[model samples]
Target chain A: MPSTAEPDALSAGAKRGRPGYDQDSVLNVAVQVFNKHGYDATSMGLLAENLGISKSAIYHHVPSKGDLLRLALDQALVPLEAISEHERARTGTAEERLEFFLRSTIRVLIERQPYVTLLLRLRGNTEIERTALERRRAVDRKVADLVVEAQREGTLREDIDPRTTTRLLFGTINSMVEWFRPDGPAGAQQVEDNAITMMLDGLHTRNL
Target chain B: MPSTAEPDALSAGAKRGRPGYDQDSVLNVAVQVFNKHGYDATSMGLLAENLGISKSAIYHHVPSKGDLLRLALDQALVPLEAISEHERARTGTAEERLEFFLRSTIRVLIERQPYVTLLLRLRGNTEIERTALERRRAVDRKVADLVVEAQREGTLREDIDPRTTTRLLFGTINSMVEWFRPDGPAGAQQVEDNAITMMLDGLHTRNL
Candidate 1:
């Protein structure tokens, strides 16, 4: 009888069948298709067609659609997770810590663009999606806790609720997925810098 | 051969045992159902079942799923259209006018919460969605223009691009649809006030 790890063994065993089609290649294609057609709307047939491969051939790499989603979300989750544990994020003044987290989060989104796009779009209709959502929200809560602490230290404005501030702060960053084309004039670093500047200084000039 | 102008005639000619239901009530039910299950995933059968009406009765109010989508998009578009023509939106200092436009836009969103939720969730896969998205982008351009004017006038910071600022500003407001529960402690006004404060004051506190 095959063990529970048999699927992984089977997927890894086929190292040369598809010629340059590894787990990463499959995931790249799957994430693109998922972003375009939506996770629920995408079918294995459509995915196979997009990959220019047969259904069984595609199955050799990933177990199912949900596994691809898991892989995609994990790639996006790592950067934000890193920020929570990073030394700079932990050992700075409230303002500096908050800034580090924000800049790091944006850098992660830029680096893992497609994965984070898929991560932000998950609607929780599937167990994989719900788990991804919970993990992302935990990341958000960690940042929100930092912001709340910043507010308590009289660094951030006290009028707005910390939760709302967190949403607005991340909302500005998340909406970039919808409009921020990679081929634009501004590079990712510039985008991150400008976003941090806006969050920190706002639109109005400091004098007025 | 009754004219479509006659609401009573439309109601009477509606194919159902219950003659009281109009297009408005059926649309209300359809929007609610659509919000729960998404526009593409929702079936006419499910909407009819939820409405306690027959498929033909549902069809009498709207020709197809696209028609219902058009109606929902119209609700969101109407407010923006109004804001464009608003006198205050045209005449104030760029920052003040933009604030007025944003505050009004938020009020409209809260008032038309469900329809706006549907509009915001739309992906431009279909002609109807594409047109709605184009109009949304046009409204964004108008706001971006205001930001640019403010920058020129030395009211707003010059470092950030006006277009990115507009996206983040509107994105922050639009995200209210995702987490906001009307049943929560903060009502729409409170939310608006906080959003205004955040947009104007930002997350960081200044000595001034």
Candidate 2:
């Protein structure tokens, strides 16, 4: 039942005898293993083996596998939720605000690719996964609302259904987890720019 | 050792105790189970239980679980590969050809959603999975080549990298597997039209 607190404080009070391990480090390794082997398939023993630490030592950091999943999911979800509430996203013209949301989302996905990948893949098999899905859906609804607003204001195209547009827009962004490499030839800035341009401007050459 | 031939003939010739099943029926159920439980985690025993038949009956239809996966993946990949080879996808301007590929792909996905879902989720853990992935990648490369051709022809906006554009383009279409229900309120034609408009026309209101 270790709580999320300062790494030093939590580690200093640890009684399980594993030194040099913090919750953050443990969570990072856990997310990697979960991504490598799916969440349900990964057991604490496998996680400990991968961490090169005893199961008890791992428990000293987090209580159960669910806690590790929650922490890992939050790594991706928190920043995403922030974008929806940000002043820029809230106050600008619906079009500008939606663009801000998209840009920020792409950045978060690029920076936290593994976490977001795990987040996107959740099939809601467990209570914890279902809760995570609820949070994810809430974020999606907020973005879709922006699309609706933009469409209402006539700044965005009105022909397409807002919900479908939102899904496709986010789908394009989420699919990056499948193949986008942070260290690859395409940089994050390039991806962000290209996504905004392609999404906001038609891919077809304009007469302008 | 049930070859995929006439379902009736295969079922009639089966020496196994169970008489009702065919390779196609078994494959349909196996794919459903595979989609429910992941490919690696699903055992022959589990598939048999879901099929309400004996393990031997299951084996009579397909030699092994890998065979089931191969068959299921083919259900999706074959038609997709066909689209690339289709005359409409080959003869038109690059933009027109790419549009045909996109529309055809959306149709295939909607028609064979369960198979496509399993195919898209493959992680290449087995030889069969790896081969399916290679084929999928080849199809992806062909689509990307279309994008490149469109760009070279100046029909598509050249500012974005063709590879990135291709990924984002197909990414939008492939993302449909996530939530696009063929049975839902939105018909396949509507989803197809929205996706094409969103990808090609941009979401912004046109000045003209």
Candidate 3:
């Protein structure tokens, strides 16, 4: 879609070429702008202005605003998909795997706060939003599957429905984006420890 | 502020009078429209159109869009504040009080789904939004205090921060707005039972 075919265009560098920015850096700038002004209010021109590049240069890296949203979603989703494949996630008791999933989720929220916030707030008004929501739901279902396995193994309670428990867990974890700040008193490590304690042990005293 | 100054104006039949709508009915329609088009995007004129009333007549019951938001927020908050004053919340042990709080919360969320949904989505963009958020935070702090008191009583784990536990509990409870459909399979009673069980007893088996 870009005039990548005119390979020499890079050396020519449009007369106003402030500086060269890579695609990843451009995408990061676009995501921030998108989050701040909101998706519908944002324009490629605003992104170009923020990145100190020509609109044509912004186009060179990403085709459209929707494409930037898709890229940001990948930033959030790829890490989650990786968690499902991790050795800890793949070869553990259901409870153990679920804990690992939650811990990984906290780290992702800290590491990708803006992108994850965007993902959580997306209203499903567009094609990109709907696709992102589907991905999020699929990830949630994987956690629900673990809840089922854990319950079936007699580790989790059979009284509560697996689907309900899964939603509760996801809600608790996803809410980290609302308040978790790495620079705040609680670090990611602290959040992970507290989340694991609350999820696996609950708030009730387990006094020995 | 409305020309309710023209009290006789009503008897005069509002020159262009249309079918009248009551305050509660108007609030309900406004909440749905606000949810659909977003609070900032929705105008009094649009609300008037939705309710099939004259713009001036719409102003008679509610002074402004801000007033509608405040009224809707009251619907969500008054019930919650009342929960804090309930006999159970006031007289029970900390854990019992906490349980009452959660149960009451589930009922309010179910009975006022649309209003609660709007409350959850509000972003604190205006004066009314900020006040609503403050009220919400106060309610959250009350739950945290109960967790602290319960932990001190040795009924809850002292290991996890009370604030963290409260946030997790609120997250799980508030998320009902996302998937709850009164007509759907899960009933309010079922949700309450499941929430209390998972939250109090946790997912693990007691091995009885």
Candidate 4:
């Protein structure tokens, strides 16, 4: 519920991120708080109080709290869902496709850093969260299969299990969400190039 | 909190894992639940119910919920702290030390998977958690310094910033918690070896 002492600034009916209590504005705030407090730890009262609106106002935009979670989950996974459609991810040589997928993934993560980080932090407390986690694993399995194919082609090494390799590669990539800063030392492109190099070439200086 | 239905399964003095609500038993159950549900989402009532003990009984051992968190955080970091003092990690060349740190970290992670995973999942919901996060970052920074040392000695590549390199290295290692089953197809030694190889040699068939 809106506090009676709501700031003087907000009394004039400041513009909602849209004309009404739009899903986008609500999501922007929800993601921030949910990211801060684990999803289940957050409460409708908290969201309403933060929005300086009654719980009914948020209800006006979305049916329940779960709806906001679903939208945030979508914000994180939808781009990767498009990854399989990328020409390179679809029909390019296994390594080429893997490269495209890696490069494209980094771009998506940086662009949607907050949502992606929120996605990683989710503990599957609810069906929506669990589904997001499952969808993430599915995307990983798809990438693992490509790693297996590349290994079959003798491009990527098979010494590690395809699943293991995929996990490690992703582990490295996903960790970026924890620390990657757009305004920090490296630009997204720089981080992308370095990551691809580390994954493909590794840390040590190579000698043929 | 013992139910009247406290099955004949638990005899009167069979005891709740030790004597009158031992911290160890309480912790063993607490860590499991904390790992399942992020810390902030978990509560004293839930922990008590799961342990099948009265809340006051648990309170008999640990003073507060934060104490349990501190214990779990210790479980995850203490081993790595020991690793830093290992001969190889301490006195070896930068590259050698980095390698030792990586291998040791993977071993420790596998050995302490659940708590370590919980440690990583924590978003510093409390001051104790934030301190844990800071300590973990401090460890990463020390490792990053080693990486910079290696680069200076021309043993490792320098194109990427050392901090990024450190995060990537950790991201890869920390990911082991996500899917590595100790009893899975690849044993810990096998996974560790493959990870080291990949880090040293890379994924593709090299043609340097």
TM-score top scorer? 2
Which candidate wins on lDDT? 2
Tens digits of lDDT, candidate 1, B50-114: 77768887787789988988887888898877897989998879888988988998898888888
DockQ of each: 0.50, 0.65, 0.46, 0.58
DockQ of 4: 0.58
lDDT of 2 at A128: 88
Off by over 4 Å in 3: A1-20, A52-54, A206-208, B1-20, B206-208
Which clashing pairs does model 4 show? none
Error of 3 at B59 (Å): 1.9
TM-scores of the models, in the order given: 0.89, 0.91, 0.87, 0.85
TM-score (C-alpha, index-matched) for candidate 4: 0.85
- For residue B193, model 4's alpha carbon misses the true position, in angstroms, by 2.0
Per-residue lDDT tens digits of candidate 3, residues B139-207?
Answer: 888999998999888888777777767877887788888877788777789888987776766666752
The clash number for model 3 is 0
Give one digit per residue, the lDDT tens place, for model 2 in B106-199: 9999999989999999988899999999999998898899889988899888788887888888889999998998678788999999998888
TM-score of the A-chain for all models: 0.89, 0.90, 0.86, 0.87
- Candidate 1: tens digits of C-alpha lDDT, residues A96-171: 8889888889888888888899999888988888888898989898788888898888888777877777877888
- Report how far residue B165 has shifted in candidate 2, in Å: 1.2
Residue B154 in candidate 2 has what lDDT? 90
lDDT for every model? 0.79, 0.85, 0.79, 0.79
Docking quality class, candidate 3: acceptable
